[model samples]
Target: MTIYRELVIHLKEETMKDIELLVIYQNAKTLLFHDSKQTNTIEDFVTGCIHHYIDRVKHQIDLSGINDLGKPYRLQNHLKEYIDKKGISQAMLAERTGIGASNLSLIMKNKNQPSLDYFFRIWIALECPPLDKILYRVEE
Candidate 1:
């Protein structure tokens, strides 16, 4: 089998057990796997899988809705807070990250989901320590 097929199989065996993965896989498979005429490269499959995972995670979070008591945190809010605390403007952040100010605003407003590259750029611009703290948290 090709590397792409192998990766799909591996993900199915190892990661599909999780509900999140299952949803992601189903959505990704529907959207990406249908195009058999396209190149069946490992990179293609991996990219699709990664996108699926992101979509699934976003969907799950959206289903939960915004917490009124501020129990659950969001990346947009975290970024805004960081910007406020650091007294940095969006234009400054955009310059530091090499992203357009409008793009940064869209991301901050949660109107667009940034790719990993953009995320890293923002992270580095913020100089946030304990990166995991910014990315995730334990439910109380």
Candidate 2:
């Protein structure tokens, strides 16, 4: 059976960019199934999501002040929780992701915000393809 899920990824300046690339699709087997295209890369997945929105434009979404070019929404950091549940140590994660334990710590504490490049690195290293509680949209 197919289920409809809404994902709002709000990457703020105070959040880790790498966390955005996590292809966490804890829903259906057809992850990001925009036209049944498998998103081989983060760009593809993102583009698929955009295309999905465009395809469903007639669904009537609340685009209040969308043309105002508003700032991005605040993101809820759940990487630490994800890591804890995975039973992976920060040192091990740093080694696997090459992101440095200190930087990882800052991200967990919501201190440092890295660039977009790190997203792919983290996603690739962690090999995680599920999001669910790993991230969510926090409309501020």
Candidate 3:
């Protein structure tokens, strides 16, 4: 089935608001809408909505376990998972955030702990949820 049908099913299951659905549906439509198209069909509308919902779901799932780091080691694992999912190369992230790839690599490998500034830069580059939600302090 198309993305729109999937979104309609999800919306029906969750009973989402029409306005909310319209806003999300429009974003997808804007991306996929073509001047060659004659009219917007139900399938097209539904596809747009589904695409938007999928994007939102991906972002939300990406933030999972961000607040559950109990140890420095666990934090490193979380970072690794995030980096893998985000498809961000260490060198690219470092360049974008003005940090050294070696430092990011060390942090991901659990050999080093990043300072707040470094963490903030990484967070911004990843666009990952709130920094506090993604970070945990190790207990003594």
Candidate 4:
């Protein structure tokens, strides 16, 4: 099977299980975390897991005497572009997505990076807008 296919299957299986763990951060640790109840948090965590899987696959491909697979996909700020293209004001987007207007302002101004949860909310608010011009679609 292709690496990408295998990775997708693995993630789907993992997502079905209840996960509990302790995460150690920079200097502190979150104690006995057993996932989140919020949809955004759960989606964000699942997105992170997908990213982790992709990275591991890429690293494996690299170590197997193959050509370099290049870097993981990273999102640049494209809120303004999307807003203009969709003909929506930042306030409207904020209201639709339930993200704070102030936070949306910060995102547009590049003052803050958005979490996956926030980004997904924006994407859904925009009626599942295409990211072809917004994010890198890394291919194997």
Candidate 5:
């Protein structure tokens, strides 16, 4: 059988058991076999897979609404959680806010802090509520 066919069968079986495991399988398989630009070393492959898995778990946490009240409002964490919950892609947000994709990525990663103007633009673009737990809250 072809590799793709084998992967399909394996994924089908995995999906019947756990969706998270299926996602991990698919990501690791793609990184190992499909990407031409992936690093050659086993260490790099393992590290990349771990990073990919962590990112997926983080997204799942956001999607699952783990937003605890009274936590400090962090722009990167809150923005990512909001966007994930609302099913908004970074590319879509960038287009809506008139920010470049790279800039938006940096903001999301907390590598760069957006200006107040950009924050307002993001708020408007995301259509966030004024008193949103993740996005904003009025301090007493």
Candidate 6:
């Protein structure tokens, strides 16, 4: 068995649960804590729960001489979707972020991970869209 396995937990909406939550920061592979003690916004709390729902199919892989969960996690982002939906051109975004068009293209396609500086510049340029809306975790 893997260190992490599938578990479907149902919680009532009227109250909060004391569950631990981990979230991916933007397109970066780093995980951020989004538990009750740290989250300041409803969006963070809700998205933490959403990540739990999405992480429903993790399994074992042979490696590491122990419980190997494997790389079932993928960085999913909607930068291009938001840009297109908002009718924001790539050139305009580049100008707003002061990043090159090619770099922005790489970030949008999830082909490359942007620096923390570049990530926030792009996020802020987009009018501070909810972090969850722009990025999410998908387990495969």
Candidate maximizing lDDT: 6
lDDT tens digits by residue: candidate 3, 1-140? 65522222444644546645775666567667753334455556666776878977675543234455653333433565677777877888789889887888987776887888987788888885544444544433
Count the clashes in each prediction. 0, 4, 2, 0, 0, 0
Residue-wise C-alpha lDDT for candidate 1, range 38-126, written one tens digit per residue: 33344455677789889666655432324444676444335766687779999899899999988889877766757899998998778
Find the candidate with the highest TM-score and give its number: 6
List the lowest-lDDT window of 10 residues for candidate 4.
19-28
User: Whole-model lDDT for model 5 versus the true structure?
Assistant: 0.65
- Stretches of candidate 6 exceeding 4 Å from the true structure: 1-71
In what order do the candidates fall by TM-score, top score first? 6, 2, 3, 4, 5, 1
Candidate 1, residue 13: lDDT: 50
What lDDT score goes with residue 85 in model 5? Answer: 83
Q: Each model's C-alpha lDDT?
A: 0.65, 0.61, 0.65, 0.61, 0.65, 0.69
* Model 2 poorest 10 in a row by lDDT: 19-28
lDDT of 4 by residue, 1-140 (tens): 65533234344544454432212231133222544332334445556777988966665432221233464533356677778887999988988889998888888776676789998998888787445434332333
Where does candidate 4 clash, by residue pair? Answer: none
Q: What is the C-alpha RMSD of each candidate to the true structure, in Å?
A: 13.5, 14.1, 8.0, 13.5, 13.0, 13.7
Residue 85 CA displacement from its true place in model 5, Å: 0.8
Cα displacement (angstroms), candidate 5, residue 4, comes to 61
Q: Which stretch of 10 consecutive residues in model 6 shows the poorest summed lDDT?
A: 20-29
User: What is the C-alpha local distance difference test score of candidate 3?
Assistant: 0.65
TM-score (all chains, Cα) for each model: 0.40, 0.45, 0.44, 0.43, 0.40, 0.48
Task: Look at candidate 3 and give me any clashing residue pairs.
Answer: 4-46, 4-47
Clashing pairs in 5: none
lDDT of 5 by residue, 1-140 (tens): 65522222233654545655555576678788998444244334445676888966665433222255565544433687778889999999999999999998988876777898988899889785332334432222
In model 2, what are the clashing residue pairs, if there are any? 18-119, 24-130, 24-131, 25-130
TM-score: model 4 vs. ground truth: 0.43
